[model samples]
Target: MAGKSSAGRTRAARRARWWQLTQRWRMVGVFEINTGHEFYSLTSMMKEGMQACIQATSNTESQNSLTDEHFKTKGTQLLEGFEMHTFAAPVFATLRHSLDISEQEFMNSLCPRANYLQFISNSKSKADFFLTYDKRFFLKTQSKREVRFLLSNLRRYMDHLEKYPHSLLVRFLGVYKIVIPNQLKKYFIVMQSVFYPDERINNRYDIKGCEVGRWTDPETGGKQVVKVLKDNNFKEQSIVLGPEKSWFERQVKADTAFLQDLNVLDYSLLLAQQPLHQDELKGKHSFADLVIRTTKSLDIEDYPTHLEPSSVPLLRSRSEEVPDGAVCVPGQHQAAAEGDGEEILAQEINSPAKDTRCPVELQGFHKHHQRLLPNLKNAVHVIDGLEWRYFVGIVDIFTVYSIKKKLENLWKNLRYPGRVFSTVRPTKYSQRFCRWIHEHTQ
Candidate 1:
C-alpha cells in the first residue's frame, strides 16, 4: 500500500510539471470540441492564417512581390478574443514552399489535434522556446529589435537561400505576433529544428569557437543540461566527415560570409550526433532505413499530403548516380557552394533587390528530413571507428555588430587582452569561426 501511494504521488508530481509548462499556451475554443480533453484549441488561428498565406502566395502573379513594402506588410486577424498578426505572410509563404514545406504538412506538423506546443526553457537566453509535439518546428520568442532586424533583411535572407540551397544556416519559416486582449504582445519566429525526425541525439554541442566563458557548468545538474554542451565542454573527438568534409567547409565559408556581410555576429554551430550500434548499422535495415521504417509505421496514411516514398524521384535519380558503397554526399559535385556569394550590403530596404529565380519545385519532398538533407545533410559518419549520424546547423544570426556590441567587445578586450571572445567584429568573428571549424573538424 505504501509503495502504491508513493508511486501515485510521483505520477501526480510529473503531471503537475507538465501542466505548468503547457498550460500557458491553452486557448479554449468558443465551442469546445472533444480532443481527448488534452488540447484546448491552441494555434487554430495561427494555422488558419498560415494556410491562407500559402494559398495567396501561390496564386500571386507579381514579379516584384518580394519588395520591402511586401515584407513590411502585416496581416491581422481576430479570433477567439485574441488578435494574431502575421508579418510578411506572402514572403514567408514563398520561403516555406522554397524549403519544400506544403500547407497541409506544415499545418498538421505544427498544429496537431491532440498535442500542442511543448515549452522548452533550456536556452541560455531569456527568450521562450516552444517545440511542436512532432518536433518538426521550433517557435522562438524574439525581441522587437530582433524582429525589426529580420524584417529589414528578409529580402536578402530569401535570396541567400535561393542561391545556395545547401546552406547550413537555420531556416526561419514564419514570423508572427500575438496580442492577447488587454495583455502584452508576443513575437515569434518559426524555425526548423536541427535535430528533425525526432532523432535521439547521443551528444550535441553549441560551438562558438571562443575560449572565454564557453564551458558548461560542472555543477549544473539537470536532465536538459547536457543536451547543449558548449565549446569548452566539447572534447576534441575524431569527427570524420569523409567526402562531406569539403562540402561542409565550403558551405560554412559561404554561410559565414553571408552573415558577416550583414554585420551579424555571435552565432553558434549546433552539432548533434546520433550514435548507432554495430547491430543497428549492419542489421536488415541500415541507420537511415530504420528511421524511414519507423516513420512508415507511424500511419503514413494520416499524412497523405506529405511526400510518398515513391514520389522522391529526384533523390531516387541521384541515388542511382552513386555507386552502391559510395557515400551520397549532398552538394559535393555541385558548383553552387563555390564563390557565389556577393556583397548583399549594397542592397537597401527601400529598393529591395529582386531574385528573378523561381522557387525550387520540390513537389514531393515536403517532409523535414527530406528538405534537411539538401542543406545540412544528416548523413552517416564514421567517428572514431564507430558509426554515427550527424546533424549540423548555424543558429542565432540576428545579433549584429551594433554600438552596444562594439562597446561590449571593447570592454572584453581590455579586460582580457589575450582571450578570444565571440563578440568581436562580424568580419573577424566569421574568420575565427571558419578557422576553428577547419582546425577542429576533419
Candidate 2:
C-alpha cells in the first residue's frame, strides 16, 4: 500500500512536468482585453532597438571604443508609425563597454524573451517597474513630462557618459514609447538596478540629506520592507569610509558638481551596506568556511541559467572586442592595499570638469566591493557598529529644473510653515546638498 502511494506521487510529478513543457511561458503586463499585440509589438521593437545599439557601438567602424566618429540616435519606427528609442551601440559605446554590457544583453534586459518578463509596481508613483527575467535593467513606466525632460537632456547626457564612461551617474539605457490606439502613448525608460540580483544588501537607504520631506512615509512598513528612508534614519547610524574616507568624499564632490551644473536636483543617494567579518565581530569561530560563506553571499541562484552574460549571443560577439588598455577592469585593489592613493584619489575626487568621468558605485567585477569600510576610524568597534562596507550612488536624476519645480516650491512653502525643504529651487538645492555632503564627509 505504501509502495503504491509513492508510485502515485511520482506519476503526478511527471504529469506536472509534461504540462509545463507544453505550455511555454506567460507574458505579464497591464492590458485591457487580453490582446496579445502588446507582447508581440513591444518585443519586436526592443529587438530592433537592440540591433541599432549594436550597430552604433560596433568596433568594425571605429577602432576606438565609445569614441563617437559621427553619432546618430538609435531607434526603430514601428508599423503603427510611432518610434521607440534604446541605447544602440554607438550612443554610449564606451560606457556600455566599460560596464561589460553587450547590445544583446542590453536588449534582453529591456525587451527580454516574451515570457522572461515580470511586472512590479511602485506605490509612490503612477509608474510601474518591470524587471527583466535576468534582473539587469529596470523598465520603468514614465509620464510624458518626464519623457520630454529626458529627451531634451539626452544629448548632454550622452556627452557626459562619453567623457566618463564608467561614471556612477544613474545609467539610463533607453527610452521607449508604445502607441495604444485610442489611449495615450505609453513610455518606458530602461535603467540599471542599483542592487545586483546576486548580492545581498542588509541595510539600504534612499537618502536626500534634507531634513524636510526626507523621512519614509509613516504608513509604509519601516525596516520590515524596502522603504525610501531619509536624513533622520541615516543619522541614527553613523557612516565611516575608513582609510578610503577621503577618496569617497572627493568622489561625491566631483559627482555633485556635475549634477549641480546641470541644474538637476531632487535626486537621492541610495546606500547599501554589506557586513564583513561577521564571525570575528560576533566572537564566533572563524573556521566556518569563509570561501563558502562569501560564495553564498553573491550567489545568483534565483535567476535562470540562460541569463549569464557569457551565454548571450550579443555579449559573446562583443566580448573579445573590448579595447586593450581600457579601464574596464578595476585597478583600485593595489592602490587601496598600499595606502598610497591620496594623489591618485585626489585627481579622481577633485576633477569637477565635464570631460572627467569616474564610477563611484560598489565596483570591482571580481570583488565588486565598495571602498567604504567601517567607521572604525573615529569610534570603538563594539560601540561603533563598525563591521560593514557601503555602496552608494546618486539616482533618480530624470527630474530637471522646470515650471513643475517652481509650482512645487510654492505648494511646499504653503504646506509647511517656518521651514525650508528639499523643494528649493535647483540652484539652491544643489548648493545645500553639496554643502551638506561635504560637511558630513569631513
Candidate 3:
C-alpha cells in the first residue's frame, strides 16, 4: 500500500511540471504572434510604396555623414535571404480574439510614436533579412535622419500618432517642436467660432467678389440703397504725388467726406469693410468710436491724432445687461439683476480675468461671481501674432470691453504691473481687440 501511494504522488508532480511548461511556451507564442503581425504590416506597406514623408532641417545635418558606398555594398549582400509573407488574416484574427482591437484601430495604432518605434524595432530582424535579400529596404530606411528622430521620440510620436493618425509621419514628427503654435492656431479658430455669433452676411448683403452693396431694410419693405461711388477717371486717380499734385491727399479728403456722409460711428469705419450688418454696428454702443481715412500711399505718421485717453472713462458701463455666460464687474450687478443674472452668478469661479489688469476694489467681483481666469489666459494665447497685427486698430476697442468685464468679475483675485489707470486703459483696448479678433478670425 505504501509503495502504491508514493507512485501516485510522483505522477501528480509530473503533471504539474508539464502544465507550467505549457503556459510558458503559450506566453512566448503570444509575444511572437504580436511581433510578427507588426513586422508583416510594415513590410507590406513598404512594398506597396507607401512612403513616409519626413521634414528636413539644417540642425539635423551630421558631420560624419556616410556615403552610399559605405553601406550599399554590404547592405546588398544582406538582402538576399529575406522573404515577404502575408499575415493579414492571422493578424486580424489575433487582434480580434486576443488584443480585442478592431482591425481599423489596430492599423491606426501604428501611427503614434511608441507604436511606430515598436513597429520599427520588432521588424528590424525582418528588415535586416530584407536588407540581406533585396537591399532596397535598407537604402530607403537609411536615406533620412527623420526616421531616426521618429524612432527616438517614440513615446511622444505614439501619443500624437493616436491623436492625429491621418497626419503624415513627417508632419507628425515636426509637431514636437511646432505644437504650441499649431495648437494656438486651432484654439483661435475655435474661440472665433464661439465669440463672433456668426451673422449670415450672405443674407444681409450683396457682396459679389470684393464689391459690397446692399438694399437696406429689404425685409421691412424700404428701399434705402447704399452704394459706394466707383473710382472713375482712372488716369486722374493715378497722378504722382508732389506739392501741387498729391493724389493720395486728395483721396483721403474724399474718403473723409464719404465716411462723414455715412455717419458711421468713428471706429465703425475701421471695420466697415467687414461684411457686418447695420444692427451689428449699432451693437458697438458700449464704447466710443473713432474714424480715420488714409490713402493707400499715405504713411501711418500722416494719420490724424486719435482722441485723448482722458476723454474715455477708465471703466465704461455696458449699454445693455451682461449676456449670460459673460463675466462681469461689480458695477454690472445692477444690470445683472435685471436679466437672467442668477445663471451668470451661479457659474463656479474657476477662470480669471481675460485682462490681467483689475482695480483692487473690483478684484473681489470675479471671486464673488465665480470666474475662470486661467481659461481666459489660455484663450488670449490662441490668437496668432500676424492675425493680431492685421486687426490691431479695430481690436483695441473690442478688447477693452472684454477685458474690463473680465477684470470686473475677477477684480479681487487679479493683480497687474503698472498704475491702475494706465494699465486699465491699454488693457481695456487690448482685451476688446483680442475678443473681436477672436470672433472675426474664425
Candidates in order, TM-scores: namely: 0.66, 0.59, 0.15
lDDT of each: 0.61, 0.50, 0.24
lDDT of 2 by residue, 1-442 (tens): 9999999999999999977764432211222112364554554554455445455445444225333432444555444444445424354544454455666566555544443344422236666655556545666778887877776666677666544433446777566666545644677776776654314456566766678756665333322234445676667465554333434444455555566667777887776666766654554212233233323323335323655655322223321422332232244422111121212333333323222122222222222322212222111011112355555667877677779888988998899876758776655665555545544542
Clashing pairs in 1: none
* Candidate number with greatest TM-score: 1
Model 3: weakest 10-residue lDDT segment is: 185-194
What is candidate 1's CA lDDT for residue 218? 44
Stretches > 4 Å off in candidate 3:
1-101, 104-143, 159-440
At residue 227, what lDDT does model 2 achieve?
47
RMSD of 3: 28.9
Cand. 1 TM to true fold: 0.66
Candidate 2 lDDT (Cα, 0 to 1): 0.50
Please, what are the lDDT tens digits per residue for candidate 3 over residues 1-442?
9999999999999999999976553232012213356444444433222112111111233223233332221111111223211111221122122212333332233233221211111111221222211110111222123333333333443343233221111111111110112221110000011111112111111111111121133232232222222212111221111111111111222222222222211121111122334643353222332111111111234222362423222232323333343343433221111122211221222112233223232222232321111111112111112111111111101112245545653552354322222222232322222222222221
Question: In candidate 1, residue 332 scores what lDDT?
Answer: 28
Residue 254, candidate 1: Cα error in Å is 0.4
User: For every model in order, what is the number of clashing pairs?
Assistant: 0, 9, 42
Q: Write the per-residue lDDT of candidate 1 for residues 67-179, one digit (tens) a residue.
A: 77777778776666677788887777676665557766777776665444544333579886666666678778899999999988888988887656557888888888877
At residue 315, what lDDT does model 2 achieve?
Answer: 26
How well does candidate 1 match the true structure, expressed as C-alpha RMSD? 11.5
